[model samples]
Target: MKRNPVRVTRAAGDIGAQLSAWRRMQSLTAVQVAERANISRDTLRRLEHGDPGVSWGTVLAVARALGALDRVVDALDPFQTDLGRARAAAALPKRVRQ
Candidate 1:
């Protein structure tokens, strides 16, 4: 399957911007959050800029460090997705066509 890098990159950038804002709102410095997440400040900076070069674990750790891990988990929860529920329903054949 083909993937669109632009869309992915844009999403990452948006998330990073939000994260950066959250850090500021919580009066956190990059070093503070990075220390909490057990990552380097450089890594945290890359994440904040939405570089997409960081590990998924690092992303989750960042969220955890900021006490927003629940949001991250909810974002990826398939059961909470209406489109997924609709598509899953469509996948099940209600009657045999043959």
Candidate 2:
């Protein structure tokens, strides 16, 4: 079992609201989304509310159900992140010709 946090970032809340809005726009109920994601409605509720206790798999599943899998995939892509790239470059012992 995962422990939930005391607070979440604004981005987390925004993402949750966005996911909820998208589900509403697609005419999907929480039960329907949960069924499609093979997760319980309660779990989906936690995920939709941005509870940190929820697994990334559950979040991805919900994204997939909402046809936003690409967005989630892109979000995890290292090349898509400047901070990640900078950190990787900084960690290298030798500098590569850019």
Candidate 3:
């Protein structure tokens, strides 16, 4: 597989770190989180270490287990931002034919 871009790697690391920090703040162990997420401890370790090979479903499961699923969903909502709301108002064509 091709290597990920630097920005992607960096973002993954940051996200992983945040997840780890949250777990710590909640006084949860890796084993506890793994069980809560229905994933293995190794998988949780890889996620906390920012391994880009992890699946999106696994990430969402972990976030949900941590009670952060709503925050994650909100963060990805474009309409939550001023620029995104403005762009939605302008409305692009339904289809683009090259």
The 0-to-1 C-alpha lDDT of every candidate, in the order given, reads 0.89, 0.83, 0.93
lDDT of 3 at 36: 95
> Which structure among the candidates has the greatest lDDT?
3
Clashes of 3: 0
lDDT tens digits, residue span 1-98, model 3: 79999999988888889999889999999999999999999999999999888999999999998899899999999999999989987897767899
**Quick one: RMSD of model 2?**
4.4
Write model 2 residue lDDT over 51-87, tens digit each, in one string: 6667878888989999999987888898778988898
- For candidate 2, the per-residue lDDT at 91 reads 83
Worst window of 10 by summed lDDT in candidate 2: 2-11
Pairs of residues at least 3 apart in sequence or in different chains that clash in candidate 2? none
lDDT tens per residue, model 1, 1-98: 55559988898888888888889999999999999999999999998998866788998898999999999898898768999888878897889888
TM-score head-to-head 2 vs 3, winner: 3
Each prediction's number of clashing residue pairs: 0, 0, 0
